[model samples]
Each structure stands twice: as C-alpha cells, then as structure tokens.
Target: MSLPVHLVPALDGVVVGSTVTVEGDEAHHAVAVRRLRVGESVVLTDGAGTSVTAEVASTGKRVFTAVAADVRRVAAPAPAVVVVQALPKGDRGELAVEVLTEVGVARVVPWAAARSVAVWKGERAAKSLAKWRSTAREAAKQARRPWFPEVDELASTADVVAMLSTASLAVVLHEEASVPLASLALPADGPLVVVVGPEGGLTEEEVAAFTAAGASSVRLGAEVLRTSTAGVAAVAALLARTPRWG
Candidate 1:
C-alpha cells in the first residue's frame, strides 16, 4: 500500500527500529484531522531528502510517535530550476506556488515586477509570503517529494538580475520573443532560471535588465498564458527536454 506522507522538521540519524516523535501542528493534523491511529503505516520526510517509513505507535492531542522500520535518503534533483514569478492578483500567487511545487521546481521567487497588479507591503507582505510557503509545503507533501521546493522572499528586479548572472541557463517567457524555449540547449547539472512576467506583462526595461544579466527572452508558443500559469507551462516544457523527465 502507498503510505500517507507527512512532513517532519528533520530525521537525521534515523534508522530501523528508531522511535520518531512528531509534534506541534504537524502531529495535530495527522492525529486529529486525519485520525491517524496506532499501527498505521506512514512515510515521514524532512523536506531535505531524508524519509522514514514507520508505523504509528501512539497519538495525542498534538503529538504522535512512530517506530521506523525503513529509512531512505534521496539525492536532490539535478539542474535545479528557479522561477522568478511576478506576483499576480488574488489567490493566483498561491496557485502558482502549488503547481510549481508539484511540477518539481526547486524554488519560487516572488518578484514585484514593473506593472504588477498586486502589491506586497508591510504586514501583507509577510502574510503573503507565509501563504506561498504554506502552499508549497502542502503541495510538496501531496506530490510525495523528498526534497521540498522553497518559496523565497519578495524579489526586486535587481535581485532577479543578480540571480540570473550565475545561472547555467536562464530564460524569460515573453509572448513576442523570437527564440522558442525548446530551441535552447539546457545544462545537465546547474541552476536553471525562468522568469515569468506579471498579468500586465513585462516592461521593456525589465526585459532588458534580465537579458543583460544573461537571461534569454524566449517564447512558449503561439498562445499567451496568464501570469499565474506561464511559469509552470514553461517549466513543464523545459523539463520534457531534460533528463529529469526522461
């Protein structure tokens, strides 16, 4: 049977027969909400490539214990892809993070691009970032990923430029770009970056800056996608050509 996966803070030095204790909100959800019971099988991951397959030993108000019978460590995905996503309006940003996590992107950087419809400031910025992180976390668990993707802090144009300068392959999804994303040769092992513009689209200045930082302006296809979806589409297309999918 496919065991239900849970997220733990860490699982270092875990081995067969080790008792693992899960606590706080994670335990609460599994014990109370999911009705996890003694002797039930589950897989627990640290989101850093370590997992323990264990049977629930006990449950409480906000805690649970499990006796591990198997442990696994996986290597992180190669050619880690980072998407610099322009913040979209409403809950679409969370949607973007959710799909990106499921699609196996390594990181999502929320960018406040020129002409972005939604703005993040003060308390809203913190709350919004938290929501994106939460979405990524849940999506990762649901996807059964050993290495969870990261949701980075809000990024400025200059920040994205700085990141692109060191990438092995960098591309920006633009409707009017001459080059197709599939036409480019990708790196086998290194950081790959894709920039997705906002609902209002990227300004010439923003495109120019990214290009100057070594990102290629590339098109996905003939049809234009929403800011919330363009990143995942571009990523899926790129992954199809990569060994990760092969």
Candidate 2:
C-alpha cells in the first residue's frame, strides 16, 4: 500500500538522507490519529510538485521528524485545465470540487450564475469557499497528486468573460448546442477552459456573453449531467485528447 501522505508547507533542499521535521496539525494527525511511529514511512508533499518519501525518525506530542530516502520535483501537467463551475446547492459544490481535483484540473473557479439556486454572500460565501478549498486539498492528497489544484474565489459572470478571452480554448457546456465537446481540437499547451452552468441551466444572455468572449458552446452528448458532475466529465473528455492523459 502507498504510505499515508501528509502535506507540508515546503520540502526545499530535501535530498537523500536529509532530515525533515513535520509539525502541528499535520504531524498530530500522523502521530496521534494515524499512530505513526518511528521507523515507519510516510510520503510528504508540498502540493507544489515537490515530494519526499521519508522514514519517521522521532515523534513528539504534535510533531515528528523523518529522514528523507527519496525526493522528487515534478513538472506541472501540460495543457492546464481551468473550469468555471457554477455554484451548486448544498454539498454538491464540495462534491464537484473533490472530483475535479481528483481528475487533475489545474484550477476551479466558482461562478455565481444568474439561475444558480444557491447564493454565496457574507459569511456563507467565506464558509462555502473554504469547504471547496478543503475538499480539493484532501482529494488531491487522496489522488497522490504532486500539484494540488486551486479553488478560486467566487466569480462574477464578467470575471469569467475576462478569463475566457485569453484561453487557448474555451468551451461552455450547453445542452442545446450542436457542436460536441469531443470534436473540438485540443490544445497542446496553455489554458483550456470549460464553463459549466448551474442546476437551472444557463440563461440565453449568459451563453451569448461567453460565446462573444471566445468560448464555443458545446454539448457532451445525449445525456445531461448534473451541475456538480458536468465539469469533471467534460474535463475527462478534454484531457483524454490532450498530452496530459496521453
């Protein structure tokens, strides 16, 4: 089995036989909750493409030390994918963030669409963003990803348009669109952005705006996926055609 992975702030200068200390909540989880003991091994990642396989050297109340036996710095994935995911009600937002992270999206931008059933404002907005971010972080660890995906702050429709303008390729998931997502030529590098609407669907004005800003309105297929799932599905399809999945 893969050793339990813990996130660290940084793994700088770590090399073979280097000593690294893990502390606070992360170490407490490994030592107290995971029952990690000296001589056992664990994987530590900075979530920025740096990771180390280290054997535990010592354990304290809320801290531990490990000796790195291996270290790796991976390059980020090519053809980075950025998803403009409209807000979904309840826990679906978290579900979307989790699966999107697991599927290797480079970034997820939470959009407040015109027809969105749930609204994020005041304290709720902060809490919801935190949940999405936390879900992505945990899912990234579960996927053993060297680079964790980012969950951007809630975005306005205008903000999304500004984003689409510079994308290498941008597609808005529209059920009525004639163009299928798979038919589009994939970019070899740079940003490939996919926009997913909310439960009630995208308004005509929203569609026009996105298209005007350089996004192609495309369909996945005959079946319509839920707001929380459509982004990952589209991303999976898009990545399958790119060098990242190849």
What is the per-residue lDDT of model 1 for residues 122-193, given as tens digits with 9 covering 90 to 100? 999999999999999999999999999988999999999999999999999999899999999988777899
| Per-model TM values vs. the true structure | 0.99, 0.98
**Lowest summed-lDDT stretch of 10 residues in model 2?**
181-190
Candidate 2 collision pairs: none
- Cα lDDT tens digits, model 2, 1-246, are 988999999998889999999999989988999999999999999999998999999999999999999999999998899999999998999999999999999999999999999999999999999999989999999999999998999999999999999999999999999999999987667799999999999999999999999999999999999999999999999888877778
Residue 125's lDDT within candidate 1 is 99
What CA root-mean-square deviation does each model show from the true structure? 0.8, 0.8
Error of 2 at 176 (Å): 0.7
Model 2 C-alpha lDDT versus the unseen true structure? 0.94
